[model samples]
Target chain A: MKLTINRNYLNDAIQQVSKAVSSRPAMPILGGIKIDVTHQVIVLTASDTDISIQSFIPIEQDQMIVATIHEPGNIILPAKVFVEMIKKLPADQVSIEVEDHFRTTIRSGSTEIQMVGFDPEEFPLLPAIDQNEIIQIPGDLLKTMIRQTIFSASTSEQTPVLTGVLWNLKDNVLKFVSTDRHRLASRTAAITAPDQYQFNHIVIAAKTLSELSRLIPDQNTMIDIVVAENQVLFKVDNILFYTRILDGTYPDTSKIIPQTYETEMVIDTKSLLEAIDRAYLMSREEKTNIVRFMTIDEHTVEISSSSTELGKVTEQQKVQSYKGEPLKIAFNSKYMIDVLKVVDSEQIFIGFSGTMRPIIIKPLDHDYNTYIILPYRTVN
Target chain B: MKLTINRNYLNDAIQQVSKAVSSRPAMPILGGIKIDVTHQVIVLTASDTDISIQSFIPIEQDQMIVATIHEPGNIILPAKVFVEMIKKLPADQVSIEVEDHFRTTIRSGSTEIQMVGFDPEEFPLLPAIDQNEIIQIPGDLLKTMIRQTIFSASTSEQTPVLTGVLWNLKDNVLKFVSTDRHRLASRTAAITAPDQYQFNHIVIAAKTLSELSRLIPDQNTMIDIVVAENQVLFKVDNILFYTRILDGTYPDTSKIIPQTYETEMVIDTKSLLEAIDRAYLMSREEKTNIVRFMTIDEHTVEISSSSTELGKVTEQQKVQSYKGEPLKIAFNSKYMIDVLKVVDSEQIFIGFSGTMRPIIIKPLDHDYNTYIILPYRTVN
Candidate 1:
């Protein structure tokens, strides 16, 4: 393989695929990034069995030549070294050539580096997915959905399926839900896809979704998602991200969401978050992270936490509106802080069934996002 | 103690003393910050046996009231919790009051925190330093000198004195030197002090100097340093920093620096640094960080590194001036990078006696700083 490419363009493409490079590869070849040079484009691929990422650089972009291909061939280079070297190359343009026996020479400005490359044939191939049924969603919307729900997914491998976010599609409306049996987050969005196409019980690992989120451009572009029997492919711009579908059935979480509340209140999101944050400093030292919330009056609420060794922290803030009986409840301040951070509304609506039941939190202006937290039982 | 102090001023004072708080305190009380509130100022102190720091917040500074003291007393609060809480307090002025039984209440805006405090008498007191003789130096100059030489200090405890930087005062000139056997860095500067106050063999731990560096103000101000029998006291503005001197004799490193050179070259500091940084990516993977430098003709030099598992990297750059015989030498790229990072010169002069002798690096424009690196004997 022989080609000259813009250093910045090559570096950007390498960074995109580097997320899939495993730190501890199951096979030595899995630690390599496969480089393929064709007549029209150069493709970089990295995979770790569970997740695979491929990025392409075309010969020309925006009337500027990004890469010049002298010959078409393929070689695999160690990802860890290649990524760092490309980033610090001393010139705007770099030339790479694969000589006999897979010895590759990379030259830029007055610097030249020779790297030993492995035969590309030894690298694992990406699973091919049938794209007959493609679901298209806005990149920013999908990124938001992932950010809002992915954090609630369980990180432990004991229940492998809970480590992924469940995706359900019905009537062109896609919904995402994730829970660790302690707290749950769900987001719903409308997507453009074939009316006849629908998927259920499809779960993608939180780790995979996070990588996809980073690859998604900030601009409002369309992303095509294709799901195979056991694989999912996300076509984002010139990048293709593929991941294996998590096996096992995800537990039904629909029944756990509270439908009604005995006590409801509207509070400023930032104010409540700040109050809980101060209380968290004390609770965190105790390792329980339990912060108590009590309604002081129709328009005021108090947040407090205490450590047996480090005294207590109490703060009161005014609520926007309250329309129920006064109540007291305690919860893990860390979880509440997480939910509040992602809430994009100025005011949030909080509903409580009782002290022991699950508490529901939602943006006052929107019904698409819902977060439920189980309150801690405290003997007061 | 009862006082209302500006949150920012209190926060800045706390941050200065927080550096001395040990993560793993030998005694439980050592993890607390002693707070002494007097009529004129509020003193915050933290000590961990080896080092102690005290910062004072006066009642008024720069025509602005920093603190209003209603009652004078003393108390000690947990450093970890108090530092974090003070940083995020919700008001500009926070009121702190000791109620009874060492229960302290800190009130800011609508938030109130009660913290359990330890007896101030139990906290370790700072060592007294004699001030009959004092050395005064510009804060910025001291900061720069520490930055240039501190990186060469040995971190291993086997030779405790090597972990400290040697300070020699003679004829109103103060010199700092540090070495870890393979590499040495020294910087010299003139200070205002009594001619009769010359002192030698005074070594301060690199760790303590690093913390002192952070507390130094960026503005040029005279800092008074008093050397005690085993403790050194630095009065930096309103902050007092005390550090224990490392025991043991420091080895003489003066002979290792080349007095004469067989080959001398002047090159742009930034250009050479960039080339070696790229080579580091390759050498670092081998864990040896070996990079070779050879004079090419009279005006050009080549920098390269090779690994048995990986291939080689070669780069050549032009030198401003070259004199004496041509030579080739190999050294650790990581150490060279550290020396180059602190060089505040556009061009650097490199002197090499031979392939095996130690190489000397200095700013081409000044004689205040010097760095010596031992070359590696490679089989090639």
Candidate 2:
């Protein structure tokens, strides 16, 4: 393969694909990034058995020639070194030529790097998924959904299903739910999809979702997602991301969310976040990370945390509105903080059904997001 | 202690002194920051046995009241927690009150924190240094000198003195030298000091110098440096930094630098640095980090590195001037990159005695800086 391509474009593509390259691949060939040079486009692929990422660079883009191909071929190069070398290449235009025995020479400006490549046939083929039904979602909405719920996924592998976020699609509404037994986060978005193109129990690993989130554009571009029996594919612009669906069934969490509240309050998100943050500092020293929330009055609430060795922190803020009987609850401040950070609303609604029940938090102005945290049973 | 202080000022002072606070102190008290409050000023100090830093916040600065004292007292608070708490405090003005038994209450806005403070009397006292003669230097210059030589200091404790940078003050000139016996870096600056007040054999740990460097202001402000028999005190504005001198004799490195050269070349510092940086990436894979430099002709030079598994990287650049015989030498590219990063000049002069002799590098327009790197004995 011989071609001169725009260095910036090539570097950008390599970076996108490098995210799927594992530091410790199960096989030596799996560590290589497969490069396929065709007359129309150059495709770069990297995989670590769990997920595969492919990025394509076309011959010409926006009237400007991106690559001038003299020969068409394919080769697999070591991902780590190739990624670094491509980023640091000296010139705007870089020429890559693969000779006999897969010896590749990369030249840019006055610098030339010769690297040994592996045969493309040795690399594992990406799993093929039949795209009979495709679901379309805004890129920014997908990114937001992943960021909002991925953190709630259990990092422990004891229950493999809990490590993945469950994607539920029905009636043109896409819902993402993740829970770690102690807490749960759910986000829903309205998308344009055929009524028959609905799927449930489509769980994807939180790690793979996070990587896909990074690849998604920040703008309101549309992303095409295709789900098969055990494999899922996401096409973001010219990049194709594929990951295997996690095995096992996700536990049903609808029963945990309370339908009624004994007390509810509307509070400023930033103010409550800051108060809980300060209380968190003290609770962190105790390792329990328990912070107490108590209603001081109809318009005021107090947040406090204490450590035997470091002392106590207490703060009170005025809430917009409060109803029903006064209440007190204790919860892990870290979980609250995580939920608050992803909240994009100015005000939040918090509901409590006495002290022992799960505390529900939702955006005050919308019904599309919900978070539930189990309160810690503290001896008062 | 009872006082209402500006949170920003107190936070800055705490951050400055916290640099000396060790994560794992030999004694638990060493992990705390000592705070002394008087009618005139509030003093914050932190020590890790080897280094002690004290910062003073006066009652008023620039005609603005920094603190209002209601009572005078002292206490020691855990540095890590205190630092983090101060940063997240809720208000601009914070009130700190020490009740009976050293129980401190910090109030800001609607938030209140009660911390269990340790008795200041239990904290270790800083070593007293007698200052008969004082030397003055620009803070920026001292920072630059430390940055230029500290990277070359030996990190191993086998030779304790090599872990410290030797400071020789003579003839109103302060010279700093550091080496790991493989490479050496020296920087000198003219200072305002008494002609009779010359001192030598003063060695300070690289770690201490690094901390002191951070405390120094970037502006060209005058700094008072006092050398004691066993300690050195640097008074930068309202902050006093004291460090114990390392106990050992430094080896003489003057003999290692070549006096005359068999070949000399003047080159653009940035171009040579970039070429060597790229070559270093390939050499790093081989673990030896050896990059070969050879004279291509009167005005051109080649830099290259190779790995048995990764192949080779080669780059050629043009030099401004070249004299004497053409030669080839191999040296540690990492060390060369380190020196190039600290160089402030655009053009550099390189002098090589032969393929095996030590290579000398100096700024083309100044004589205050010098670096010597020994070439590797590679089998061609």
Candidate 3:
């Protein structure tokens, strides 16, 4: 294949696909990115066993020339070294040519590299999926939903399905849920899709979903998502991300969420996050990174943590309001801090049923973001 | 000890001394910083078995009141935790009170921390040294000299003295030398010291010397260096750093640096460094990360590296002149890049004795910077 392309566009496409290229691949060919130069477009593909990414650069983008194929062919080059060489090449545009014998020549300015390329036939074929059962959603909204709940997914591989995030769709609202048995994070977003398009439940590996979010740049446009029996594909801009769906069904986490609360308090999000961060650092040398919050009066709240071996830290954050009986509870500072960072509200309302109950934290004025954390028992 | 100290000043002092606090300290008390509060100054001291740092924050610094002591006493607080807490304190001035029994209470604004403090008498004291044999040099020049030669020091502790940089002073010239057997780097600087401050040779651990350089702020002031029989002390500004000097005679590296060359070429320092850096990234996957350079013509040079498994890269750099006979040699790209980064001159001249001998690199102007790299044999 022979083609000339803009350095920036080619770099972006290569970077997006390179994320899926593992350092040590089960199949040696998986470490290389397959480059196909067609008459119309140049497609770049990279995959490990878990996920595969393919990005296409069309011939025309915003009136600028994307690529011109002098000869149509294909070649597979080492992803890492090739990308690094191209990035450091001292030229505005790069020309890539593949000989009939599979020798690839990359030239930019006076710098030229001749590398023995692998036959495209050796590269794995793209997974075939019917797009009939597809739904369209705003890229930004999908990215946000993934960020808000993906962190709660279990990283352990014993229950493979738990390592994935569950996506449930009804009407026009999309809910994302993730749980690691100890804690749960759920977020929902309003998406525009056809009335006929519906999905009961789909589980995609949390890592793959997070990688897909990074692939989608900040664009307000909508991307099409298609789910085949055991595969899910997200067509984000010029990139297509495909991941194999988990086989087992996800556990039901609805009952674990609290339905009511005995006490609720509204506190500034930034203040509480900072206090939790400080307490987290203080607990590193202790058995448990524990931080406790106590409501003394109507407007006074005290956050304190202590380690017999590493001393104690007490931080106070003022809250706007607190109701019901005064309560004191201790929980992992890291968990509460991670959830607080994703909540999109200036003030957060924290609910407490009792000292040992799993506390629920949600936005004071919104219902889209919800996080629950199990509290640690304080030894008196 | 009872005192109220400025938070920023306390943070800076804690940060400077915290480097000496090792996570796996040899002794329990060695992990803490001894805080001695006198009527005039608050001295913070932290020490490991190898190096010790003591910084004094006086009652007043540059017209700004730093610390006010109500009761003069001493206590050793955990360096790591204490530093973190001081950085996060909320108030401008923090009140630190030590009870008669030695419990330390640190309060800033509404935040308070009660940490277990050890008796100051248990802290290890730095060895006392007479100031009769002292050498004064520009702080900035000393920092530059350390950066230029420390990289060539042997990192492996098999030969303990090789891990240190040899400091030899005679007359008004101070020389710094470090060698890892394969390559050697030596630099010299001119300074004025007392007639009695004549030193033949002293070796300080490169790691300790580098850390001491960081303590010297950006200033053109003079720094007093006192070399004891088994310790070296650097007194700069209000900070005093004492490190145990390495015993045993340093290997002679002066003979390894050749006096003449077969081929000499002058090239732009930035261009040469960038080309070497990019070439290094490509060759790093191989065994020695070797990059070869050959003078094609009087004004042109070619740099190339090829890995049998990975691809090859060739870059051309324009040089001002190529003296002596045309030559080609290969050396470790990483070492060349590291040495090139320290060159302050715009144009650097490289002198080669032969293809097998070590290649010497110095500024075109020959103003005190020199780097020698041993060549690796190329397999046919």
Candidate 4:
């Protein structure tokens, strides 16, 4: 485009949209980023078949000047090559000039690079989502919700809807649930929305959620979420992340959760994670990742695992609190470790409703996080 | 062996000798590290076919006691497993006890790991090198010299000697030279050895030199270079690095380096490196990394490269000084950039002999570094 911009802002914008640009696109034009330049703002858009992203840059930001527009123009350059050139350019301000035949000249101080630009009309524009309703939420909380529940989604392709995280909103409480038949993870947060605003069982792909999380700011910035008939859009500051919603309805998992538990134990999260990691070595020898934990005495829980070729590993740690009947259970150490890693708390409470039921896990200090994992049957 | 040692010291020693341990050994016993414990010192040794390294831990160092041996014995432990266990041990002092049938028990705090150990007799002992001659040099200097020429060594195994850097010592001067037939890099340094102690044309494998460089201390620690008939040993403090010398004799590259030049240009080494890097893009486009440099005026040189498919790149900068007839030459920018990256001087001198001969590159403020690169033929 016929404009001058700061190198840092432009670099960041290009990288954000590049997440949607595939190296080998079904259409050749999909490999490029559509650059739309105007006197007020410049928009960069890139899309794959499933997800699309658009980033905007204003002339002045935060009371400082970032770029100056000499002439308003638009052109699409090769994304990969343009990114590499912008990264190594040795100037504070970068200028792009498109001449006849769509020939583009990029100048930054003493370094000038000329590239053959493609026709802007061939590039796909941003998809128009029917944004009739929208809900605003904190960026940091949304990111945390995605991180906590997305990992529990199934990676298998047979059930396409299971590969997404389900979003359920009612009475201003937003809850996210993800399950792969064996285990499930759920997180909830309170949002300041209208009393009548409600969205039920909206499934978003795990991959798209992760990409949007990365684009969201780490701090407490406000993000606008717009749910359309077939697509969802997440607007964070000057960036808009859009993804297609899964067609099928998310299955109901509420009946599987238990209201009462046969046994519950509170233990230090750090020590439990470490003990499980140590037992992981033994699980490899056994051919199945089955690590068992049993309550012994009044204050300790014994964690042990065994392998036929390699030896067995056993260790006992003092549990903070234990109630109900003394019980023994076995589960995949990797799944337990992964769930424990995402829960940020000094102590965790694990609930068990007999040996056949799914075990419930929750941070003692945080009510917003909850995880449930099924146990593997072992003949001891 | 039965011993209690500082965890940090033991971990460092294990890592030092593990560099010589091969993932797939010719013999099963060769995969283990030989451990010999005595009241005074503990030794860790590992060897592959091409290189062997031994590290020793003394009873006391810098007025601090490192380890104490309760009983003196010898046993070999699996290198990879032992290293991993040592890294994750949760104790300040680690105790190792070997029992009958070569069963080893390692204890650190409450964590204990049992690993299967090989018999000491099965592990091959270190090869004895005849220490009749020795040369002492600074570890940092040796490391720098190795880095400057090792990159020029041929990666192809067709010519075994070309895969090594030649060491020539005479007239109280030591020079390192390496070439892949297309280009050659040579570095010379003055040593304080006896005049009669002369060694000429000792070629050591580039892979061995690189491994030894990583073990060398970053400071000015003096390293003892002991040359044997077929093996060369580098001794630094408690570590002994031994490597086999290449079998073939290195070819004489001295006659190919031109003595005089028709054109010499003194320019800022940093600026010239940056200019060549920018022109590097053009060479990639042309399918043959051919970038041309020509004197434009009394104090400026124009660097340009073009790709048939992509466009062209051109840049001009003022030279500090020029002493030669106006001429143009083309060469591979990658080779020029590699040589310039290793040179430490602020200003460098580039000399050209006509247009078809090799170009001599040396630092302006120093006389120790010299690199000669052959020019490529380009059609005008």
Candidate 5:
């Protein structure tokens, strides 16, 4: 097989697919990227068993000859090294030739790289899918939802389901929720899908979801997500991302969310974020990383943290308003800071019932960005 | 002890001296920075046994009251955390009050930090030298000299002297030489020194030398480097960096560098560096990372590398001239690439005597940088 392609075009396609390539694959052949040169187009595929990314480069890109194929063939080349070599090649056009013994030669200008390749037949085939059962959402919206909730997913594999984000759809709306047991983040958005697009529970690994987000460029492009029995496929313009679905059921986290509040205060988001950040830096030397908060007046709130080894820090910030009784409470400063970063609001309202009760943080204008953090006990 | 200093001024001084503070210090007291508040100035000092850095902030910074002396006193605050706290403080001027029990109160704006301070009397005092053997050079030039030769020093402590750079001074020139036995780098620059300031051999640890460079700002100001019998003091503006000198004599690397070459080749420094970089990336899978070069003709050079596991890469470049005779040589691409990166020249002339001999890469003109690398044997 022989083909010539524009170096920049091939580099872009290879980079998109290489995101799914695993440096240490369970199967040796899985470490390579499968390249298929057909009469119409050149396709690149890379997979790490859990997630597969595929991109197709058309014969013509912007009135330029991106690829000219002499024969229809396929070969699997080492994904990581070949991609790096092609990126460093000096010429504008690159030619690739595959011999009968699975030897691949990539040449551009005066630089030529001859690498050992594996037979494309040995690489795993893309799983078959019924494209009818799919949910459609804008790429940027999906990426935003993933970014907000994915960080809360448990990184450890001890509880497999918690390592994935629970995606549930109901009444033409898609909801994404993630939690590591200490805190939870959920985002919901409307989608133009049938009300009966029957899906009860689907947990996709947080890492796979994040990789899918990275593959999609930030645009108003739409992606079709299809969840089969045990695998999921995302179809974009000339690209496809497939990931395996988690097997276990996710826990019910609805009850832990606060339904009522005894006291509420509205504070500037940036000021509170900065105050908590300073408190967090000081609390790092303490055992619990605890920071205390109290309503000093109707328009002022105080934040403080103490460490026997490092020191103690206390600061005050002015807020828009405060209600109910004045009180002092302690919570993990890092957790509060994390929630504030993702909850993008100019002024945020925080509700507290007591010292050990969960604190609810939400935008005062009733937007969908709401977060709750369980407070640590302060024995005062 | 009481002091109110401008936060920016204190932060800058702390950042410079904190480089010498090591958390896992050989001496426990070295973990904290010594703070001495006198009538007129506030002094901050940090030491890690091998190196000591001290900086003073006077009372005249923006008419800010730096120190009131309240009874001149001293204490040591944990270096790493204290610096971080001061950086995050809110107020422009910070007031620090130390009680008799060593409880330190640092107040800035509404933020208050109470930290435990250790007795500053336990801190190690740097060796004081009375003999004034000093050489003066531009701080920027001294920083550049340190950056150029310090990377070649031996990292292993097996032969302690090899881990230090040998400084030789005579005839108004200060020469710095460092070698790990495999390769050597030496730089010579003119300096202003008194006639009595003569040193045949003085070794300073490469780690200490590099840290001292960071303390020198981008001002074209001159710094006095006083080299004593057992200590080296770098006095730049208000900053003083003192380092314990390595005692043993360094090896004589002058005889190993070849003065003449049988074959010489002149090539564009940027092109040669880029080609070597490409060859290095391909040779990552090989055992020795060896890249071979052959003088093909009067104006052509061929570069190639092959690994049984990853296959082969070959590149060729056209040059201005190849003198003497046709030659073939192989060397560790990583080492040569590093040396090429630091050599600043548009055109570089490489000189070689034999395949097994060390190659010297110098600028087409002696006014530019020079580098030398040892060749590795290629397997037949």
Candidate 6:
């Protein structure tokens, strides 16, 4: 196998696939990236069992030749070393040639590096999946949807299905919901498709979506998402991202979200976020991370937290509007902080049902984002 | 104690002293910074066992009132927490009041934090040191000298004296030397002081100097360095930096440095550095990090390294000049890389004594810097 490719093009492509490669893969061959070069394009692929990334660089792009392949073949090179080598190469063009012993030679400028590689046959091939049902969504919006919900997923392995963000696509709107059983975050966006094509309970791992988001360029270009029985594929430009679909029935979370609220208050997002942030520093030492919020008057709210060892912090700020009985509730400050991060509006409406009930936060001007946080019982 | 100071001014002062504070200090009170307030100044002091830093923020400077003190007293606040709190304060000016029971109230805007702090009396007092034998050096140059030689010091605690950089001053020349018994780095600079204030073998811990280098502002102002029996102090602006001198005499490393050499080659420092850097990656996998250099011809030098598992990297670079017998030698690439980083000339002179003897590297046109690296023995 012999090929000469543009340094920047190869570097970027290798980096994209390398994220799917694991350093401590179960099989040694799984730690390598498969490189396949044909008459038209050079394909770089990496798989770490849960997810696989394949990126292709065409021989000629935009009337300019990016790669010239003298011979078409394939080789499996160690992902970590190959990426570093290509990045540090001296010239703008790099040539790679593989010999019978699976020995690879990489040359650029006056520097030549020869390294041992694994056989491509030992590596896993891309899994075959039925891609009849396809949905197109804007890349920028998809990335935002992933970011807004992924962080709410459970990191623990005890509940396997809770580690993924649930996707429900129906009526041309794609809704994402992620809950770690402690807190839940949901976001919805309207797409160009119609209700004729609908898919539900398609769970994708939070980590998988995080990697896919990074691969997609930040633009308004359309990205094709193909669904299968147990595998889902996201296509961004010439790159294909395949991930395993989680197996389980998602719990019905709507039963827990209160249909009616006992109190509602509108406050500046920035002011409340900052106030809770300061209070969090002290509560962090108490091990509970509980910060208390009390409504003092029609236009007043108090954010405070105290620890027997770390002392106390109290911050009072006037809200834009408040319509609720004067009360104080304690909850995890981190949940509030995370929910406030994705608030698209300057003012956010916060509704509380009871001291022990889950509090809801919604964007004041739009119905696109909503967050629910469970409060902790505190003895006043 | 009561004072209202500019937030930024107090924040910057606390950060500088916080460097000397340790997270795992032997004494609990040592984890706090002593705050001393007077009619004219507010001093922040922090000290770990190895180093102590004191910074004074004057109430008035440059015809501007920076702080207004209503009362004068002292208190100790936890270094880490206080610094974070001051940084997050909402108001431009922050008022700090220390009352009975060591309860400190820090108020800024509508936010107030009350925390229990240790009594200032529990903190250790600064050690008394002789201030008569003082040597003056420019702050910027002192920082440069430390950066050039500190990395050469041994990081292992087995060799206590080798972990300290040796300072020898005579005839208005300040020379710093550090070695780990395998390699030695020395730098010399002439200062604006007379020979009457000469001192020799004043050893300071490399870690202490590293922290001190960060405290000194990047300016050309003169800094007074005071030498005592077992301590050294540096005064930069209004900050007083003190470090305990290491015990035991530094080894005589000058004997290992060769006065003359068998072969001398002058090469571009950057080219040789980069070549070795690439080769080092392969040699690093072999466990020795040994990169070999051979004089191929009158003006050519070959740099190469190989591992049976990771393959090899070879680079051929042209030199400015070469003399004497053509030879091949091996040395630790990491040491070469570190020494090359501090070379002051574009063209550096590399001299070899033998295959196993120590090599010397210095600036081609000047004798301001010298580095000696012991070569590795290779079976050819």
Please, what are the lDDT tens digits per residue for candidate 6 over residues B235-269? 99989998999998898877887777888889999
What DockQ, between 0 and 1, does each candidate earn? 0.81, 0.80, 0.59, 0.40, 0.72, 0.72
Q: Which ten residues in a row have the lowest lDDT in candidate 4 chain B?
A: B80-89
How close to the true structure is residue A80 of candidate 4, measured as C-alpha lDDT? 53
Q: For each predicted model, how many residue pairs clash, with residues at least 3 apart or on different chains?
A: 0, 0, 0, 0, 0, 0
In model 1, state the lDDT of residue A341. 97
Q: lDDT tens string, model 2, B285-307?
A: 89999999999999899999998
| Model 6, span A1-380: residue lDDT tens | 99999999999999999989987988877888899999988999999989999998989989888999999999998775567877887789999999989999999987899988898888887889777777899999999999889989999988879999999888889999999999999999998654498888999999889989988897677999888878898889989999999988788886877888888899999888888888888888788999999988888888998878767889987789888677789999988998888777899999999898999999999888889999999888
Clash pairs of candidate 3? none
The most accurate candidate by TM-score is 2
Candidate 2 residue spans exceeding 4 A from truth? none
Tell how far residue B150 is off in model 2, in angstroms.
0.6
For residues A235-257, could you state the per-residue lDDT of candidate 1 as single tens digits? 99999999999999999999997
- The runs of at least 3 residues in candidate 3 whose Cα sits more than 4 Å from the true structure, single-residue gaps closed, are A60-63, A66-68, A219-221, B219-221
Candidate 5 chain B minimal-lDDT segment of 10 residues: B63-72
Q: Identify the superior model by DockQ, candidate 3 or candidate 5.
A: 5
Question: Which candidate do you rate higher for TM-score, 3 or 6?
Answer: 6
Scored by Cα lDDT, where does model 1 land? 0.93
**Fnat of candidates, each listed:** 0.91, 0.82, 0.65, 0.25, 0.82, 0.68
Q: Which ten residues in a row have the lowest lDDT in candidate 6 chain A?
A: A78-87
> How far in Å is the alpha carbon of A237 misplaced in model 3?
2.6
List chain B TM-scores, each candidate.
0.97, 0.98, 0.96, 0.96, 0.95, 0.98
lDDT of 1 at A45: 95
Where does candidate 1 stray beyond 4 Å?
A: none
Following a full C-alpha superposition, what root-mean-square deviation does model 2 have from the true structure? 1.3
Q: Higher TM-score: candidate 2 or 6? A: 2
